[model samples]
Target: MIPRSISLAIILSILLQCARSSTLDDMTLMLSNMPEDGRLQFPELANKYGYKCDTYNVTTDDRYILTLYNIPGDTRRPVYLQHGFEDSADTFLLRTNTSLVAFLVEHGYDVWLGNMRGNKYSRAHESLLPDDLQFWEFSVHEAGTYDLPAMIDFVLKHTGQKQLQAIGHSEGTTVFFVMGAQRPEYNDKVKLVICLSPVAYLHHSSPPLFPLISLVGGPAASAALSVAAHGDLLKNSSVAVDLIKVACTQKLLSYEVCAEGVFFTAVGRDSEQFEPEFLPIAIGHYPCGSSVKTGAHFLQIAARKKFAQYDYGLAQNKLKYGSLEPPLYDLSKVKMKIALVVGKADTLTAPKDLQLLRKQLPDVVNYHVMDWEKWNHFDMVWGKYMYVFLFNHIHEMLTKYYV
Candidate 1:
C-alpha cells in the first residue's frame, strides 16, 4: 500500500500537467481566432482609419536607420510625436479616432511619428545587423544624441520649416532632454516641447518591481544583466504577440490579473480608464522591442537615483565618462520652451521627481497635472477618456504657441 502523502503528491502533479495542457490548447485556439486587424502594422493601421500615411527612413549619425511615419496635413506646423520605451510609432494609433495622432491630424497639423533605434520599426544599422551584439549596445543616451537630431533635421528639411513642435512620452521625453542637453544647437530647431510623464531624476520612482531590478548587487539585477547579455529583449514578433494576447485576453489568465501583474504594478492602477477590448491590439504592438542596454540604463537611473549617463564600473567609467561617476545631463542646457504633464497615480514618474525636475528646467512654459485621481502613466496614451482629459489640453497648448 502507498503512503497517503506520496499518493497525493502524484495526483497533484497529474492535475498540474493537465492544467498546463489545457492552457496551451486554449492559447492555440485563441491565436487561430484573432482578428486580422490585430496584426496590421502602423502604416496599414493608420490607412485603415482613412488617413494617408507616408513612411520615411532616416539614418542616424550612428548609422542606425530609423523610421518616421507621417500623416500629412495642409499646414506646415509639423508636430513630432515620439513613443515611450519598448513601444513603436504604432502606439499613437491604437485608439483609432480618439488617438493622439488622429487628434493632431484633425487639427490640420503635420504629424511625424518617430521610432527610436532598436525598436521593431527602426532596427537596422549601416554596418551591424540586428543579430549583432554591437548593434544592440545603445541606450536612450544614444537615441537623444544621434537618432533625434537625424530625424529632426530630416523633418525640418522635408517640411521646409525652420522649427517644429515636439511631444514625447516617457523615454521619449528623456531622449528629448538628452538631445537638448547634449546637442544644444538643435534646441533652436524646435519651437516647443511637450513632455508627457517626463522621466528625469528617478530618485522617487514608486514602481515596486523597479527597485528590485535596479538593485546593483541583487539577484534580480544579475538576472536582468544575464538576459540583456543575450541581445534584444521582447522584440516584436506576431507569434509572440499572439501568445501574449491569448494569455492576457483569453480565459487562460483573467484580464484583471494580467493587467495588474503587467501594467498596474509597473506603472499605476486606473481600471476605469483601461479599456478591456483594446487589450489584444495593445499587446500586439507594444513592447515593440528594445535593447537590454536601454533598459539597463533606466534601471541604473532608478538605482542611482540620478539622471546620469550609463555607468560602466570604475575603470570603464574613467575611460568613457572621464570620471568615477557618470556625469549628469545638464537640464539648464535644455533652453527650449517646454510644457510638463503628469499623472497623480503614476508610480513610474512620481510627483516628487517631477517637482525636482521643474526646479532644474530653465524654462517651463506650462505645468499641468491630470485632475483625475486615478490617472496613471499609460493613461496618457491608452486611456479611454484621453481626449477629454489630455488631448484637449494638448490642443490648447499647441494653439497657444503655434496658432
Candidate 2:
C-alpha cells in the first residue's frame, strides 16, 4: 500500500494544480469577452451588479459627439460627475460598488457621468471621422467652452432641473472653472461645485511623469504625438491594454510591476488599499485618448502656472485674443458656490496651487483637506478609508446644500 503521507502530499499537489487551472480559465474567458473598443458598457456592467444604467449622446457646438452615463435614483438633485485626464466614468466605477457613484446612487441622487470628446465613449464627430486631423486638434479650452456647456445644457433640459451639483476631478475641475468664467450664465445652473484634487495652477505639480513631459516642451511633445498618432491622438484600445489584461489578471507575469506602473501616474498615499486585480481592468479603460493639443495645453499649464488659453505664438496669440499672450481665465467671473477638496499627499494638485485658486474664486464655500497625511491624488477614488474620511463630508455638504 502507498504510504499515507505520500498519498496526502499527492492530493494536495493535485488540488493546487486544479486551482491554478481554474484561475487561468477565468482570465482567458474574461479576455475573450472584453470590449474591442475598450469602452466599458456601463449598462451591461451595472445590470450585472443589479443596478440600472442609461446613456445619452450630446453633440458639442464644434460637432464632437460626447457620451453621458446616467444611474438614476428617486432624488431630485441631479449630480454631474466628470472624469479627470485620460480617465472615464469607469475611473469612478473602478472601485466596484463602494465607488462614489454607487454611494450617491444608493443615497438617492440622480448621477450623471460625462465623457469629454476624444475619450473612449466620445470619439464621434458629425462631419469628421475619428481619423481626421481636425478631430484631434482641440485642447481643454474647447472642452471647457463647448463640451461642458453642451453636457450641462442636456442634463438640465432632460431632468428639468434648474440647478444641479457639479463634481470635478483634475482636468474635470479645469473645465468647470473655465466654463464658469467664459460663460457666467451657466453658474446659475449649478447648485454647488465640488473640486476634487482640483488642478488649475499646476506649475508645482510633481506627478512622476511631469518632469519628462516638461523636459520635452509642450510644443515639441505635441508635434511628436501628432506624428505618432497620425491624427488620432489616443485610440480606445492598444497593445499595452491587452497585454496588461492578460498578464496582471492571470497573475502569469509581472503583476506587482504592472500595479506599480498603473498607480505611478497618480498614486495613492496608501498603496495597501489599491486593488491589484482591478489594475488590469482600470488600465484597459483609462488613457482613453485625447487630442495632442490637450496634452500640450497641460504641459503649458504646468510650465506657466496660470489657467489660460493655449499658448499660440505671439502672432497667433494676437489674432486669437487681441494680445501677445493668452489672457488668463477670469476666475472672478466664476460665481458658483465652490468647494475645494484636496489631498495632503497629492503632488498633482499641490496645496499651494489650490490655495492660489481658492483666492481667485468669488464664492468659496468650503476648502477641505483630506484628514490623512498620506491621502494622495487618486486616493479620493481609490482609498479604503474614504467612507469615513472623504465620503462622509461629501454627503454632509450635499445634504446641507440640497434645495
Candidate 3:
C-alpha cells in the first residue's frame, strides 16, 4: 500500500548509475539513497491493512537498522521476522495479502522484520567502505551480535512489552541460534523462536558450486576478485548468474539443454525457476559480494562440517592465500522454541543438514524437512507456491507458541 511515486526520481537517478558499469560499492550507495516512501513499504503494508511500520538504526555501530511493522490488536504480543541471506525485510513484505505477515498484521500482534548487514537495508557501517570486502568483516557474526539484539531491544522499547515471539528462515535461523548461544539473556527476551530450515553440523553439496568453490575458490580466489574491486560484486555476480540462468531457462522452455554444464547445480536452485519473489526493481541495490578471502573463510566449515571461524590464511593455506580466521559461534545454547522448514530436494543445504541442526538443538519445537518434492535452497523464499504451502503451518505454530 506504500505509494509508488515517492521520490521515484531519486531512485531512477541512482538506478542510472547502478545500471552502467555497476560494482558492489555502487549498489551499496543505492540503498542509502532509497526514497523515503519506498523504504516505508513494511510500515505502509501494515498501515494499509491497519498496521504501522517504522524503520530506524538500532546498531551501536550505526550500521544495523531494523524495520518494524506494527499491527495493534487484542494481543499485546509481538512477532519478529528475520530474513534469509541476500534478502531484506522484503522477504516478508512483498506484494502479498496472505501469509503469516498479513495474518499477524490483522491479528494485532506487532510484527517486525530485520535485515542483517551485507544485504540491503542494514548496510550502514560507520567505518567500513562498501567498495572493500573488509567493510563486511562480520559476515553472519554481525547478524547475531549486532542486528538481532538491536531488533529485540527496539521492539520491546516501542511496544512496551517485555518479550516477543521470533521466527527465522535459513540463515535467519542460523543467526537466531548464533545470537541466543552468544547472548543467553536474549533467550529470555524471546517467548519462542520458529526457525525455518535451520542448518548446522552437516556438509551440503551444491552440485557444481561445491567443486567450484572448493577447487577454484578460497582466500586466493578472493584475492583475485579484489582486482575487479567491485564492492558490490554480489550484485554483479548475481547479474552474471541471472544472465546464465536466463539462457538455461530459455532452453528449458524449449525442452533441452544448451551447453550442459554444472553451474545450476552449485547455485542451490534449478536455473529454470530461480525467478526471485519481488525481484528488486533496482537489482543493483542487492549487495552480498565478498572476496574469496572472505569466502575462503567458509571453506573450513564446508570441509569440517561445523560452524568454525574463517581461516586467516595461516600456515595451512599460506602458499595461495593469506591467513585469517573468521569468528565462529556455538549453536548448542539456543533454547528457543524453534521450527525448521527445509526442502527435501535442496542440495545447497540439504534437508539432512536441517536434520543435523535439529539433532544439535534440543529445544526445537517443530521440524520439517519438507517433502517439497522439487524444492531447493532458493525455493523457500522465491518459489511461487511458498506463501501457499510453505507458510501455512507458520500461522498455527506461531499463534500456538506465543500469546
* Per-residue lDDT of candidate 3, residues 167-208 (tens digit): 787668767877887787888788888766565433765644
TM-score of each: 0.90, 0.86, 0.71
lDDT tens readout by residue for model 1, 115-150: 999888998988999888778888889999999999
Candidate with maximal TM-score: 1
- Cα lDDT tens digits, model 2, 135-176, are 888888989999999999998888888889978888999999
**What is the lDDT, from 0 to 100, of the residue 79 in candidate 2?**
92
Which 10-residue window in model 3 sums to the lowest lDDT?
Answer: 251-260
Top of the candidates by lDDT: 1
| Global Cα lDDT for candidate 1 | 0.82
Please estimate how well model 3 matches the true structure, expressed as its whole-model Cα lDDT.
0.57
In model 2, the runs with Cα more than 4 Å from the true position are 1-40, 207-210, 216-221, 244-255, 265-269
Q: How accurate is candidate 2 locally (lDDT)?
A: 0.75
What C-alpha lDDT values do all the predictions have? 0.82, 0.75, 0.57
1 or 2: which has the higher lDDT? 1
Candidate 1 Cα deviation (angstroms), residue 209: 3.1
